[model samples]
Target: MTSVQTEVVEDPKGLLNEDDHMRDMERLRMEIVAIRQPFDSVMRVTGRIEPVDPVTWTLPNVAVRIEVESPAGQRPVSRVYTIRRYDSALGEVEIDFVLHDDDSPAMRWLHAVQPGDDVWMTGPRPHFVPDHASGKQAAIFADETAIPAVFAILEAWPADATGTVWIEAGSLAAVDELPEVEGVEVHILQRAKDEAAGTTGRLFAAARSAVADVSGWTVWAAGERQEMRDLRNHFRAAGMARDDLKVLGYWKKGTSSSELDRMRLAEYARMRESGLSMDDMRDADIAV
Candidate 1:
């Protein structure tokens, strides 16, 4: 496992010598310390965009696999991701940018590039592994940002294992280009931002009901921060094991990635401090 730690400074161009500009540029690269790894080495993968499944394309060097480096003393993690699919043949990763000015450096880089543009690839440290029960099925709730990871996990599952997926998109048009997998069910939740009030709760109810009939149920949710928390709460309230759920805040309303870290970390801390054990909650739990 590997861990990564990164810090960003604005106007980094003023901090280096003329001959060391290249090294400074490399250091100035946008990075997120999502994981820590001792043996994890970052590879600058530069490849042509390789088109895979019809709905999904590859961003050559854009796909990275690395061990997580945990300078934070957290567990080691390593994960793979297709940051962007740049070319059907080669070049940097091609990531989608919604054209928002409030994006991180990565998002800015993605939005600023053309078809043949190059990108720098970095760490996969601090990876997240599915924490589901060995014999149980996995259910995923995601949006566009989380799709790649969801796909990775589903692809990695044992042949005998099965699962379902529920995706939320801005519109029905968002359903374009998806991976085709055997024994996986996909559902879409399309609603305008203003119309999405109370939607998370409704979906959680449906998911809870669906999980109730299954043997070993593991819940994974990603998307809007508030909705993600609600889904997590629903699982916890339903007595899902503490270790059986994974919730992520892919992004949030009107918030940049930099702004999201503190909120999510604080929320996670509160969740851990709530201190409601699985056994105690399980005893009082009722199925949806």
Candidate 2:
């Protein structure tokens, strides 16, 4: 559910407009009227919105920019998040946040906010769409940071589509409850105290050994940087086609989101020069 809002600019009157190339950057005002924290590290904020009238595309799971605070309290920041829920009827939208660290920009701002607070949500819209028809099964791998996108994707999957999901977290209590849905097998793995984050030891071994059958799965993995790459490599080596796998680096352990975005873009440019679509590397007998 990641969208690019590179050209969106805010005017002195607080109105948003984008370059001609980005015709979809028209802004809509919203309010942070409610917030929910189902898990200690996860936060969900609801936006009391006005009718967009005809802009019915701003639904749940779309990518949006959430207002945040800076460490020095000098300037404001914006973090990308997935729309947890977009209730047109209720005129409200919800966004979820997973705190990797207490001082992270998004978490810091969230911690200081109250009901009726003002928060801005901008969009480049959503680009990740579940390819249920591409295969008989899809493999979804995520950590707590990506649970929002994972569940959002799962809910959008066709009723008849079947798949598996692996959620690896530092602690079970951290990702305590997950919504249940049919046709998907959810596996929750807790990281041992000594286990380092990413897909190196326990989590990797389990995903490899436990899921012996990886024949028809289209993989979508998002989490710590290298882990996502490793998981994708594992599946690719195990006879899965590259075009069928989608891997994203939500955060690079110690990197800031902005820094990571820059790294991602540079990597993307290099990959494109080499003719890779990031999501599509190999298509030999695989679904796109």
Candidate 3:
């Protein structure tokens, strides 16, 4: 959830040109319009951004890196979040922050942010979506941290495609918020109140038991780093295509995202030296 900031220069007209390569890379100032706790585990923030248009800004599973101050207020930190909903007509974007017990930068910012607060962010970076056009059944595995992304994906889900989603969360209410697609079935793996998140292997176990034949499925799994890596390895070993299995490690247990970002940056430097692009970098190969 950490990123390296890049400053993008705007064009002469004071608006990003549509053909600009960094159109989506520029810094965006979002004015907080509302903040609410839709569920015990989530803090929903609705923010308004400029130049909003359905065709240009609306994309499934888009993410943003919001700059926030560290607990000591001495340094700025960035945290990535998925856009849970985007209302182009209203020029508002909804971001959900998953609640955790730790006093992380994002958590601190979440508690301190308020209505009318303006936050600077970078992105609308489109993440992966299910390969519905492949004509295969989509298999989705997610934990609470990934629920916002799951919500966005389901909202834009194709009507003719079929899929199954397995979510691990402490509350059924969080799962209920997901859009119910006609051809998609969703199963919830509820955790106990005392149980810590990312500690259970229920998602991996359920996926192994339910998906007997990998040939008919395309996978999208994201959550804890180790769990996601395990899921990717399992499916790849079962002969699933590289492109068919889109797994991402949103965060790691017992590790801060800042540390993860550091490792990624080092690896990226190595890749750049070898004339490789960002697409050549693999999250599962990061070795924690």
Candidate 4:
């Protein structure tokens, strides 16, 4: 059995003794402590289908809401995900998973999930909602693994909200697998699709074009830590403010998680000590 926090109510104890009063006070204190504890939850979702599109999946919010169960009575360690699709009729929602080359907990979970078997998830807590009225557009970029996040962003965007998306894939075959978006001008840059399709070069060129016209643009790029940093520099040179761009090194090439974390920490320390700007990192060869 699990202990969950609940609201405390003060009830009059009819016992006419001070000892009884003390017991009641102690009980009240215990209840208060329990109430202060965070709610930890997880959900066991069954019968989820593997993504046929490779870029997105469909899982319903109903299952997601109920499948949340607490594993350790601690607040659920939920992650922010881009919802690829939410099917009301079929009662399903789709989430994109970033599958790295090596195994990690999240990747392992994705790999191990069977069609009939259930997967544990915690929260779909909403975070940022874009401003559609401001005439400002959302700019998104993602590599193969982070495509789910990109899809989630595109899926939730308002019907009239127009934007641009840049995706990097291994080959033309991978690019052909991309989903269609009505308002989004989706561009697939093949990174190593033979020697001809240079994805990074294509992305850099596309971004340069976007940065040239800053009318309605908020840029975001993820994947290939080094590439993200270089892209950031490219935008900065083109006159985009750091605030307008959201760049992240979702993962680095040939880096262990520990190494990546340490490298980031070291970068942070350097920035703090020297007050270096994004441009500084680019010149110093500090890849994202």
lDDT of each: 0.46, 0.62, 0.81, 0.47
Q: What is the C-alpha RMSD of each candidate to the true structure, in Å?
A: 13.0, 6.9, 5.4, 15.3
Estimate, for each residue in 14-37, the C-alpha lDDT of model 3 and write its tens digit. 222232323446567899999999
Candidate 4 lDDT over 195-257, as tens digits, reads: 322234556566777657755687867666667777878877867766677776655675443
- Backbone clashes for every candidate come to 41, 0, 0, 16
* lDDT string, candidate 2, 179-204, tens digits: 67798888888876666566444446
Cα lDDT tens digits for candidate 1, 61-81: 123422222234532222224
lDDT score, candidate 3, position 40: 92
Alpha-carbon error at 229 in model 2, in Å? 1.4
Give candidate 1 regions above 4 Å deviation: 1-108, 115-121, 129-133, 192-205, 213-215, 262-288
Model 4 worst lDDT run, 10 consecutive residues: 28-37
The positional error of residue 203 in candidate 4, measured at the CA in angstroms, is 2.4
TM-score of every candidate relative to the true structure: 0.55, 0.74, 0.89, 0.52
Q: Report the number of the highest-lDDT candidate.
A: 3
Residue 206, candidate 2: Cα error in Å is: 3.7
* Higher-lDDT candidate of 1 and 4: 4
